[model samples]
Every structure is written in C-alpha cells, then in structure tokens.
Target: MTKNELGIQAMQKGNFEEAAKYFSEAIEENPTDPLLYVNFGNLLAALNDHERAIRFFEKAIEIDSNTATAYYGAGTVSYNKNDFVKAKDFFEKAMKNGLESSDLFFMFGMTFIQLEQPRLALPYLQRAIELNEKDIDARFQYGLCLAQFGQMEEAKKELSIVVEQEPNHSDAYYNLGVAYAYEENIDKALSMFNKALDIQPDHLLAGNAKKLIEEAINR
Candidate 1:
C-alpha cells in the first residue's frame, strides 16, 4: 500500500505516531506533490500542532496556488486559532478557487457571525442549510442570526426544528424561550426556559431568564 494510504489507516486506528511517521515518509518520497503537504498539514492539525500545520498548508499553497484544499486547510486552522479575519480571507479564497461544500459554507457563515456581522452571515448560513438541512449546528446558528436580525418568528421555526430533532438540546430550548419572550408570550417563554433548565440545571442564562420572567409575572 502507498505510504499515504497507510498513514490514513494509522490515523483511523488512533496510532498518531505511526500516522505521522507514514505521512512524513510520504512527504519525503513525494516532495513536490501539493496533496502530500496538504495531507501532512491535516495530520499535524489533528495533533494540535497548529504552527507546523500552517507551514505545511503554506507549502502546499506555494507549490500549487490554484488548489482550494490548501486554502481551506489554512482557513480551518486559523478558525481554530481564533484568527477570524485570516480565516475569512482564506475561506473566501477557497471559494474563489472552487472549493464548495456544506462545511465550507458553514465555516464562512460562522466567521461572519464571529465578526458580529449577522446580516452578512445569513445568506451563507442559508446556503449551508440548503446543502445539508440535517445539520443541527448550522440550523441553530441560522436561527440565532435570524433572531439577531429581529426575525423572531423565523428564528422560532428553525430553533423549534432543532429541539424536535434533538430533544436534549438545552440551548435550543433556551433560544426558543427567547423567541417567545420577544413575541410577548410570557407564559410560553417561561415554560421553554423551565424545560431548558430541566435539561441543564446549571444553564445560567436560562436560570436567569426564568427568574426574570417569574418576577415580571408576580409584579
């Protein structure tokens, strides 16, 4: 088997040292192959060696500037490092280079959210949902973006779907409560908050929301 294949097998088996050795050998044997550098970069990123991973990704980009995979890899590493600006730049480059996928769209959407531009986040998130409707995290973020944009009813629909699909999602319940509260449905909001607290007793936001609603009702 090729060294790259063996490396992948090792990674799947959780033998990270063996995986790294195989990937390193593969890189040595195929020094000019951008894919090799990209694969090695992915392995290093999995090992949490972000600096080395970025170097490998940069090397891949230097060797083959047109390949979207290298840019996407760098973008993911930057996102993990909390470098949102760099992540956004790389992700846009990846898209410009024809790397289109639900995950890529989701990351791009999330980057906009991190930059506190929910309006800009909306369409990318919608595209991600179109690509993979079953992605609960994307839907959750879409709901949040909608709420931030003052589209509370739309947010409620999305968050409701999330809670229905994943009943134990405390955050979904909490967000649903927020949506109801915005509509002035105080009883429904309090009930949703109570449900969130039932699932996660230490949910600070839900606890506080429940207390505030109760006080308002008492007054």
Candidate 2:
C-alpha cells in the first residue's frame, strides 16, 4: 500500500505517531499532492493540533484552490474553535469547490444556526437530511429550525419521527411536547413532557413545562 494509505490505516487504528510518520514521509515523497496535505491536516486536526492542521489545509489550498476537502478541514477546525464566521466562509468555499457531502451540508447548516440565522440554516439542514435520512442529529436540528420558524406541525412531524427512530431521545420528546403545547393539545403535550422526563429525569425544561400545564389545568 502507499505510504498515505498506510498513514490512513494507522490513523484509523489510533496510532497517531505512526500515522504522522507515514504521512510525513508521504508528503516528502509527494509534496505536490494536495490530498497528502489534506490527510495530514485531518490527522493533526484529530490530535487537536489546530495550528498545524490549519497550516496543512492552507498548504493544500495553496497547491490546489479547488481542493474541497482542504476547505472542509479548515472549516471544521474553525467550527471547533467556535469561529463560526470563518467556518461559514470555508464551508461555502468547499461547496463552491463541489463538495456536496451530507457532512458538509450539516456543518454548513450548523454554522448558520450558530450565526443565529435559522432561516438560512433550514435549507442546508433539509439538504443534509435528504442526503442521509438516517442522520438523527440532522433531523433533530431540522425539526428545531422548523419550530423556530413557528412551523409547529412540521416540527412535530419531524420530532415524532426522531422519537420513533431513537426512543430514548429525551430532547426530541421535549420538543414534541412544546409543539403539542403550541397546538393547545394539553394531554398529548403532558404525555410527551412525561416521556422526556422519564428518559432524562433532570430535564429542567420538561419539568417546568409539566408544572405550567398542571397549573393551567388547576386554574
């Protein structure tokens, strides 16, 4: 196998030092290969060596501005650092460079969410779900974006599917409760809140919502 391939295998086996050595050798042998830099950047990113990782990604971009994965690597590093604006920029560049993976869409969606633009987040989140329907986190976030836009019925539909797919999803149940409450379905709302509380006993929002419902019923 190629040194880069060996490096990837070592990385997957959690042998970071070995992987780094292999990647270093691979880069030395093929310095013009943008993929090598992207791989090394990914390894460094996994190790939380953000500075070196970014440098590697930049090097890959310098070699080939159209290297989408290099932009994605830089975006992920920026995202991890909570630099949402820079992350968004890099993700957009990745997209412009033809990176259309579900993961890229998901991160782009999340960056918009972090930037407090749920409207901007909705389409990307929806695209992520379309690309990978089994991605529960993307579905959950899509439901949240729907609810944020006051699309309660749509939110309920998505959240309900989440609970069915992952029964122990407390946050999904809680969101369902909120959607039902918005629709004035008190009993169903209470049932959902109870389910959330059962899954996560310390769920403060569910507990508070349950109390408020009870107080309203008592009055």
Candidate 3:
C-alpha cells in the first residue's frame, strides 16, 4: 500500500518507470529516510545509471553514515563498473557498519580474486560456502582458490560436490580434471576431461587437455 512497497513490487516485475516514479514519490514524502535513498540507488544501479546511483548512495550516507545498506549498494555499483578497489573498500566499510551475509562475503572474495589476491580471497569464500552451501558459484570459486594454493585434494572435493549437484556443469568437470592431472592420476584426469567435453564439445581447454593426456599416455 505504501509508495515504497509499490515501488519494490514494480522493481520485482521489471517495470522500471513505475518503480522510479513510486521511489521518487516516496523520497519526496520522506526526504530524510536513508532507506528510501538506498532503495532508489539500487534502482538506478539496476538501470545501469551507475553515476546517479552512487550519488543517491552518497546522499544516503550523508543522511546516515552508519547505513550499511547504502555502502553495500555503492559497492555493488563499483563492482559492476569493474572498480574492484573501490568495491572492496566499500564492502569492507559495510562490514564495519555491521553488515554480514553470504552475498557480501562472496562479493568480498570475488573482489579479492579479481585483484589477484587469491590468498586473501580464501577465507571470505570459505565463509561464504559455509553460510550457503548450495551456492554453486561460490563453491566453484572456493575450489579454484584452493587449487591456486596447491590444496588439490580440497579443490577436488569442492569441485566434485559441484559436479554431483549439477551433473551438466562442464567447468566443474574441467576443473576436477585439472586437479586429477595435478595429482598425476592421468586416467582419471582423462575421463574427467572427456566428461567435460561431452557436456560442452566446444570447451577448448577441455578438448586440449584431453588431447595432451592422450599423447602423453601414448608416449
């Protein structure tokens, strides 16, 4: 019934114009409500108006510096823009402001990975997986980070779970194959690569891996 609720409904239905109208009306009615500005910032971010979205988020922060949601919204926009440094900063600030969730931890991990700090990414990704075990992407990233750290057995365990949960995941199969190859289990690696290729014939890395394994076995 409220304008903010109607705006949320419109946003959920992908009616951006109506959502914007309602959000604007809500802001007009309660100019000091930091949540209203945060919601509007989210809408603008979804619309790819990153500059305006950051402005709204900053306004929300101006009104209430302790609003974690505003920082999170700004961080999301920064992440979308590939400004990983700013994204990581804002995400950390959100955490300091008492925001804690699986999604936030996942983003923190991903931002670290993007920054080529896989070591730093590990703890956040591990926590993310602990919080939401069903998150395939988070599990995959965690597995990849483990692999980077030479924890091949742990990597295989995580990737195996992904394949078990989503049988058609070609990337999981490919990564699992890589882990097997690292462990020098050539036959198992070859089988895993073949499975990945079966699911995605155009997977160049899997195809190349299979070929290399076959050649090495023949030699």
Candidate 4:
C-alpha cells in the first residue's frame, strides 16, 4: 500500500505515532503532493498539535492553492483555537474550492454561531442536515438556530424529532419546553421541562423555567 494509505490506516487504528511516521515518510517521498501534507495536518490536529497542524495545512495550501482539504484542516485548527474569524475565512475558501461535505457545512455553520451570526448559520446548518440526516448534533444546532430566528414551529418540529431519535437529550427537551412556552401552552411546556429535569437533574435552565412557570401560576 502507498505510504499515505498506510498512514491513514494506522491513524484509523489509533496508532498515531505509527501514522505520523508513515505520513512523514510519505511527505518525504512526495514533497509536492498536497494530500500528504493535508493528511499530516489531520494527524497533527488529532494529536492536539494545533500550531503544527496549521503549518502543515498551510504547506498543503502553498503547494496547491486549490486544495480544499488544506483549507478545511486550517479552518478546523482555527476553530479549535477559537479563532472564529480565521476559521470562517478558511471554511469559505474551502467551499469556494469545491469542498462539499456535511462536516464542512456543519463547521461553517458553527463558526457563524460563534461569531454571533445565527442568521448566516441557519442555511449552512440546514444544508448539513440535508446532507447527513443521521447527524444528531447538526440537527440539534439547526433546530436551535431556527429557534433563534423565532421560527418556533419549525424549531419544535426539529426538536421533537431530536427527542424522539435520542430520548436522553435533555437540551432538546428544554428547547421543546421553550417552544411550547412561546406558544402559550403552559401545561405542555411544564411537562417538557419536567422531562428535561428527569433526564438531567442539574439542568439549571429547565429547573428555573419550571419554577418561574409555577410562580406565575400562583401569582
């Protein structure tokens, strides 16, 4: 097998050291191959060597400006470092360079959220869900984004599915409670909050919401 392929196999097997060795050899064997650098960047990123990972991704981009994966890798490193502005730029470049993946879309959406631009996050999060319906986190984020826009009905629809698909999701229940409360369905909202508290007793928001509802009823 090619050194790059072997490196990927080793990485998948959780042998990061072996993967690094293989990736290094592969890079040495084909210094001009942008894919090798991208792979090394991925390995470094997995190892939490963020600076080195970004360097490798930069090297890949230097080799081929159109290397989409290189931009994606850099974007991820920037995101991990909480450099949302840089992450947003790199992710946009990756998209422009034809990188089309649910993960890429999800990251871009999340970056927008971190930048406090939920309006921009919505479409990308929705696209991520469309690409991979089984991605629960993507759907959850999308639902939250919808809720942020006061699209309560749509948000409830998505959150309802989330709770159905993953019954132990306390946050989904809490959000559903919020949606119900928005609709003035106090009883249903309280029931949803109770479910959230049942799943996670320390869910402060759910607990506080329930208390407020009860207090309001008493008043």
Q: Candidate 4 lDDT (Cα, whole model)?
A: 0.96
TM-score (all chains, Cα) for each model: 0.96, 0.97, 0.97, 0.97
C-alpha lDDT of all candidate models, in order: 0.93, 0.97, 0.95, 0.96
lDDT of 4 by residue, 1-219 (tens): 999999999999999999999999998888999999999999999999999999999999999999999999999999999999999999999999999999999999999999999999999999998999887898999999999889999999999989988999999999999999999999999999999999999999999999999999999
- Candidate 2: residue 166 lDDT (0-100): 99
Worst 10 residues of 3 by lDDT: 99-108
lDDT of 2: 0.97
Off by over 4 Å in 4: none
Q: After superposition, how far is residue 152 of candidate 4 from its true place, in Å?
A: 0.6
| Positional deviation of residue 23's Cα in model 4 after best superposition, in angstroms | 0.4
Q: Across residues 89-178, which tens digit of lDDT does each residue of candidate 1 receive?
A: 999999999998889999999999999888998999999999998989999999999998899989999999999889999999999999
Q: Give the backbone clash total of model 4.
A: 0
Query: What residue runs in model 3 are displaced by over 4 Å at the alpha carbon?
Result: none
Candidate 2 residue-wise lDDT, 1-219, digit = tens: 999999999999999999999999999998999999999999999999999999999999999999999999999999999999999999999999999999999999999999999899999989999999988999999999999889998999899889889999999999999999998999999999999999999999999999999999999
